[model samples]
Target chain A: MNVIVEAGANYVGVIGAGEGATGEQMVQARRVGELLARKGVRVVTGGLGGVMRAACEGAVGAGGVTLGLLPGSDRADGNQFLTVSVPTGLGEMRNALVVRSSEAIIAVGGSWGTLSEIALAVRTGVPVIALGGWPLPGVEVLVAQSPEEAVEAAVRTLAR
Target chain B: MNVIVEAGANYVGVIGAGEGATGEQMVQARRVGELLARKGVRVVTGGLGGVMRAACEGAVGAGGVTLGLLPGSDRADGNQFLTVSVPTGLGEMRNALVVRSSEAIIAVGGSWGTLSEIALAVRTGVPVIALGGWPLPGVEVLVAQSPEEAVEAAVRTLAR
Candidate 1:
């Protein structure tokens, strides 16, 4: 069997709670996605709700491509802001795909799932700029106390 | 080009925040990993820190085969709990590998990254059981109001 490895970067994945849409966390997520969008970056997410919705909303509001990586094969469930939806049918395993599709990850305030994505990022050595959580191990671990700082760190890191 | 799809429950991908040394979310994540472990599930993650670490701890505690998918090509950065580590030099894209290799996903509670994973799950048509978050649309959104419920939903969904 022959295996082919192909890589492409069209999006930056954002991980966070689907809840708490009206808090500082939500504000931070939107700002990050917006900054990336204003720079012509496409924002990708799990697509259906919460932070995904906020980021997508921000990216689309800024005239950027908002791609939603959905978990199932159905398209009806996707958030309205998604420009494109890639259905993986892998359930939570699809989290891997979200992180894989991005050149880097910007984690906002998150719970356990965000932690896993960061773990995935750290394990993979992807430059994850954490905005509001405990710092990741070893990598740049840009402890940005503000959204602007997080976006700045990501821009700098991706530039490298 | 022909695409060959592999079948069967070869591994169980566990998604967590990596901060779950102690907490309800961590407890729930551990419970889910343990359940899968008891069922002979081969667990996989980013292979370092937080919920990833906790899940590995749970799986190992239950005597399951744990695979840590690292972002870098180096083995030194991998989690100490992993029995096997797959190092992908693709950096954060390693998240895609973790998702692609698994048959299912269980989101314990999340933040930005977890939301992205959930979006991926919804887009991909993967059956994701959210332990904590808003209700997902289209797919079977098993809102596990508790840890046991989350684990049960994840297992039941995977069985289907």
Candidate 2:
């Protein structure tokens, strides 16, 4: 089966904790999504809950396009805020799709899953802007103090 | 798009270094694939060179079905030994797919990519049987001294 890669549109992944994300992380992720959408960048996410749901909500609320790469085979498993959802059935492996579909990544919070994505992105030369995540010593992860800063870093890196 | 998860095919992932794998690791990986295929189990891999290619070669030589989930968008990126190849276009992030698609994993050797798969499997409750991989102090990875032992451990775990 052939999977088409969307052309011309800038895609950015917003990755973070799924179920147990803190309230502050959700808020930050939502803001990051909103800002990215306003910039005409497509917001790509894991498409389940917590930060993923919040990011889609914020982007959709702003009348922007959001793509959810779901872990299950059912599209209904995605959050309500997604503009388009694809059930990848890759489970946590879908995390790679999320990272690959984007030119840059803005990590909202820390989780084992998130760490895996970050590691993958770094390994594959995708720039990452961590808003609030665990420190990786000897790894070059761009740190962002706020959502705005994260968005700015991501966009700037994409520009380069 | 709906991805059909092949039913009734017992899949086990053979993961390790891609381009820079050692000769010994390639030999071990091939033996593991041959053994698994002889047991009527399907072998899954990342569909590139090094350990992945050797494993596929052994499986196909043994007349076993081998599936390669490629990192690129083109099926040509897969090795010749693959009976079927799916171009996932997920890049290094496709490591998650490799882990998620398998009932158990037999790591022929270790790399950052291999480590990511192992981490994903451990987090998601998939069993792992490591052959000459790194030490994970807290993770529950079964150790195998040879490819025969590794395949035995993998099939035994799947049985349970």
- How many clashes in each candidate? 57, 0
Deviating ranges (above 4 Å) for candidate 2: A1-9, A34-40, A58-65, A71-77, A83-96, A134-140, A143-149, B1-10, B34-41, B57-101, B119-124, B132-149
Query: Can you list each candidate's DockQ?
Result: 0.10, 0.26
The global Cα lDDT (0 to 1) of model 2 is: 0.85
Native contact fraction per model: 0.11, 0.41
Q: In model 2, how large is the Cα lDDT of residue B35?
A: 93
Model 2 TM-score, 2 decimals: 0.71
Model 1, global lDDT: 0.70
Considering chain A alone, what is the TM-score of candidate 1? 0.86
